[model samples]
Target: MSVFPSPPSSPPSDRRRYAIVGLGSRRELYQDGIEKVHHRWSALVAVCDSNPGRIELARRRSTQNGAPVPLGYLAADFARMLRECRPEVVIVTTSDASHHGYLVQAMEAGCDVITEKPMTTGAAPCRQILDTCRRTGRRCRVAFNYRYSPPRSQVKDLLMSGEIGDVLSVDFHWLLNTHHGADYFRRWHSHKRNSGGLLVHKSTHHFDLVNWWLGAVPVSVAATGKREFYTPAMARRMGLSGPHERCLTCPEKNRCGFHLDLAASPDLKSLYLDHEAHDGYWRDRCVFRADIDIEDTLNALVTYNTGATLSYSLNAFNAWEGYTVAFNGTKGRIEHSVVESNYVNGREAVQGGVAPGGVKIRVVPLRSAGFDVEPWSAEGDHGGGDRLMLEDIFLPEPAPDKYLRAADERAGACSVLVGIAANRSLESGARVQVADLVGDLPVPAYAPAGARGESVPMPERAR
Candidate 1:
């Protein structure tokens, strides 16, 4: 790794000081925004992680990107970073369960917080973070970058305009192919205590999008989840005998389809492999580990406060990625489907179906004919929502967003509560209510249907 100049004395008056807590691959998404696109508006004041190699690597990458090298802080010195770096905003990109600690600390220290999705793992942490945000009166922005994706944004606009009339219900199903989904089993996410399972960790994105799209909060949820696939028996059925803790030393490395050669790629090596001394975290654990607690298959039935019901399902070991969602409304039904590329999370290129032809959004009117809606597409990962979301986050003077795209603690809490409820339902085998998890949670602000009042109403033309 390349060593570079020291940290700058102080941020300019035009910029906001930022300290990122996690130095994993997800850190790059935010670092790129600060270095290349938002230089004028944001500065990387400090970077913190448990691993020393990642800290140095972040500094090297920042040097390469023409950004000022930030001060490095170990995970133990997170409070010291707040005291010395005095960052105006603390970005929590840590593991799922650890987010609440950083969020609470930052808010209590009179700093705003921006966190990766799922917010925190369980209901207790979620309550604590919510209380901290309210008590400290600081903002906590959850990065649900999917909300800004062009095709999804179009769906939001269509719903806001009541194009499909009042959304009565939804049927949403998301699939994660073997490559991408299996990667979770290889990392810290395999344990329910670490990630609160995929329903909370991954589905937070999907649940949040649904809540925002419908302009409502989830009220009740009944769910079921199990580990049907990715079991030891399945691995043995593939003619792979014996048990291995991780793939790095597995005898079936050549034969196993799920082997991840972390040492082969320099980036992966430097990011994870070379830094095992400090954390002892293995990034290439066996996908079929017997101790893995997270469910590979999950189904949920949710009712929103706005009288909208959703039947949702998630399957990890699927043939392809992406999703199919349909909104049933009074006037008509709008359906959206996508096909996405599958790969290990931080490996090759960006994730999701950003390509032009892979996504389709259609409208079927109740009375007239149906028509295909050409989606508003953008380039980059997660259907190009990351860049747009970054613009909103990093820009000093962002344009007035009527979509209410910038999410606060309420949005953060409401998003995770659905999954939290679902997780409870999975355990109890009964319907779980969101309010029962977090009592009297405030509603997220959404624009009224009159947002498109200036536009003329369209009637179907004679075919």
Candidate 2:
């Protein structure tokens, strides 16, 4: 481990100051944006993490931008950072459980907030954060990066133009192969309390995209979830014996490629292995243990505020990553997908696919309609929305795609609200209403059949 830098102030900047919390996998994504985008729009003023080394690592990484590194503060406490650093923006990159805590504090301190997904584990905390933002009159943005991808954006544009007509319903399915999905089982995400299960944590992205595309709000949801695969008993049934320190040390190490070698990667080692002194939790563990509450597979039926319907499913133990989504509209239909041959490890993804990486789009016109599917444009990753979304977030001035591309807090909340409802539905074995979760956050415009492509004005309460 390298010696961490101490708090040092950079020259004054006109841009807003920001701080980061939770130095984990998601932190890296924000860091990517900070290095690439924050230079102009914002400045990383401070970083906070429970672990000393990660806090140190984040501080150093924030400063050393490969040029004249800007100096910033380092603190283990977010509250202290707020008082000392006085950042205008608070980036909550912490674990799922800690999201609401930092979010409330930041908003109450009169700072804008941008946090990673699931909003908060459940509606209880989500309500608190929402209330805080409302009372304090500060903005809260959820990082649903998937919505900004291009191919998906095209689908969004198609729906908005009524080219696909009124989006009556949607069918969405995603498969996370063993290489990709199993990674969740290895980390803190295995617990529902920590990651809000995949439905809230991961599906929040999928749900948000669908809401944006349909231009409607989720009204009600009924769901079911299960952990049919990856358990200690399953491992035992597979004839694996106990007490192995790690996968690489296991007798069946050769047979299990899903095994995580925690010590091999410097990033993993510095983040988890080296921090055992501060926290005893082990990062590498079998996914099937009894304490792992999150589901491996889940299914849901959703109804939108405009009465649009959606059937959704997600599976985590497939052979590859990516997802498939089909939108059924009154006039036409659009389907999109991106399937990987294998997982990308180190620098290279094991080769196996005919199509390009990321989601692809196919729009089909109804009989007597003008559009053609064969001549349609193709998109890459999240349907080519990633780069475009980055541009929307990072660019100093809005571009043509920016207005069509960005999703506001209401859009973000409405999307995750469905997952929050679904999680409740799964728990109660009954239908859960979206309003019960998010209390009627405003939604985007909706068009009835044959209506012109005009923005359906939102009511004051809806807004």
Candidate 3:
């Protein structure tokens, strides 16, 4: 492992300095973008994380054989990265609960920030981050790469083209197969306190799609959720009399279908299995642990300011991983279904993208015969969204986007509030108002329901 750089030291030659916090599985998306894809224009100045082992692992993975290793810091010295390494932008890929702190402090320390989605865990932290952005005048960009996915971008284009007329309602159901879905239960994400459950952690991407597809802000959300699968009882029912704390030591390792061999994948092996001593963060905890607090199934009804609504559901343990979304509009209905290959995150190069030949889009015009609409196809990682987002963030000569895929703090807050409200509704068994959670937020400039690009405000709720 590379030694931590001394304070007040200069970073690699003349290039934009970026410091990344959190060396978990998701860190590769941004780290590789800076080091491999856009290394010339951007320099990875420093990496900080609570886990020394993960930090060392990231250092090895991100640095080329002959390249000067980027600096490393313990999480406590994050401020040192700002003052000493002097990063122009801070990239936060930390645990869900810690994002707001890093985001707010980085901005206050005179740096722009880029963060993974959901922005913050809940409404309190969301409001703080928003207020910090307003006070510091620093940009906080949330990575919502789904908007840039080719087939999804095409869906947005079709909706904006107005052939579907004004959107009135949306039906979206996302499924996560056992392979990918069970992994969530193994990590910090299994608890609501750490990840805000899947509603905030996983569904942020889905809810953002709905908000952007309709070009509206969510006003009210009523939801119901439960953990029907991934239970200790289910494991016993399957005849696994003995289940270990994790897959690595389980007595039923060979017999259990959900067992994850951390040693099999070089990436997962180096990144997680070899580093368990640093933080005791097991990479393969049993999916049916009784301590798991988040729901495995969720259903929500969301109303938007544009009078558009969403009927959304998420099933964590399913036969396959993907989503089917249908938009109902004044003119017609647009439906899209995608099947995605599911793998344990960080265990493989392709995390979650469109499975080969897994995309289908259909259009049904009102008072007209419905026909299949062939849309633009995608190739590459993350359905070609990650590459585009990387270029938009790092490259100086990227194409201007009409879909407005780049998301700001406002958009990030708007998306997570839906899930946050859903979590609340799940507990109270009543509809929860989004505005009641975070006060009113400015509506994002989303592409209009028609081809016209106009900014529309979600209707003001009577407080």
Candidate 4:
């Protein structure tokens, strides 16, 4: 890895100095947030990555953003970067399993941290993060942009307002169509050690949303997972001879539907294809490779501390993308669904972009007609949640949010532990308690919701 010299000294401004680790595509959100959107209050001081090419690319991006080029460092020199850059905050966008190390070290070094979701892959790292936060007395924020999506936040508001009464149970199903879902099997996420499967890496967004919406803690989970869709058998069924090492060198690329021509997209080529020699990390691995360990289909039954149960399923091979969720409450039911446009990561397309007229919401009161709700709308990626969340993160003092959308380590653990327990359950063929996975995981702070046993008007003798 090529290391750049120390950044030149300059007169300090009131803007918060920031350093970022891991220069993958996900880091661009925060990078642009600091340089372009919130430049008045935030500044990027340093960028680090395992691959030198990405580090150079990040610096070039800084120049392109009309910001001063930050110093660049290899992963081994992270501590050096922190010491030299003296950033007030460290933003971590590393691979899922590598998040905990950077988070812990950044906090111990007296810098606040903002990490991309899933926090860490497994229970042990989760415990380490919680313990490190407690011991160091530093802030660790998990960027859960899903919570900031207007329609989703509207759901939170309705629940807190007792629109659906105290929720008795929940049914949520998330679908990932071939385009976006298959991308997971193409990258490092294909291995459980790297991503903890979609159950954690992808569903962390969904799980955190549920935990936040209901104001509850997950207590136990029973789950089953399998990889039936993206496998050698499926590859054969599709008339391919068998899975090849990767799409770049595959002999059957012309016949395979899953082929990803990284060189075709300028963004993918610059971000991953051109940087291959540095790490030997293939950006277009075969989805049906036999070495893939993670599951493509998953189901889990979760029980919450609030006495509510959740029946959730995630399927990677679906006709459409997005999710349908319903909250079954004592007085009524709230049904919410969204259809997202399918797009692979690192491409020019919006990640998790909502389809036109994609959002739907309905509330059915007991013994009464159900009415449709005009879904709240926003104007950016991930249903505009990304822009709103960036404002929350980079702004010095964001407006006080009633939804309590800002999440710390507690909320992070709550979301990750569910997936962790589910993984354990998948192995043991039995229920796994969240507490058993990690103790002292306090319930996350949530906006007030309808409490159980609260007085409820009797439904007018259901006709």
Instruction: Give the candidate number with the greatest lDDT.
Output: 4
lDDT of 2 by residue, 192-296 (tens): 878888998889888887776776667899999988776667666766663244554466766665577778877667767777677665777765556677888
Give per-residue CA lDDT, model 3, range 320-414, as digits (tens). 99999999887779999999986678876676877777999999887667998786765667778888888899885678888888999989999
Model 4 segments beyond 4 Å from truth? 6-11, 447-451
Q: Write the per-residue lDDT of candidate 1 for residues 210-282, one digit (tens) a residue.
A: 9899888788999999997889988988888944788889988999998999999776888999899878988
Error of 2 at 229 (Å): 0.9
Per-prediction TM-score, please? 0.94, 0.85, 0.94, 0.98
> Clashes per prediction?
0, 12, 0, 0
What candidate 2 gets wrong by more than 4 Å, as runs, is 1-9, 67-76, 242-251, 341-359, 368-387, 400-404, 444-463
Model 2, position 375, has a per-residue lDDT of: 21
**Each prediction's Cα lDDT score?**
0.87, 0.69, 0.86, 0.92
Best-first order by TM-score: 4, 1, 3, 2
* Residue 343, candidate 2: C-alpha displacement in angstroms: 4.6
Candidate 2 TM-score to native: 0.85
- Give the RMSD in angstroms, all C-alphas superposed, for model 4: 1.4
Candidate 3 versus truth, CA RMSD in Å, comes to 5.0
Tell me the tens digit of each residue's lDDT in model 4 across 228-300.
9999999999999999999999999999999999999899999999999989999999999999999999999
For model 2, the run of ten residues with the poorest summed lDDT:
345-354
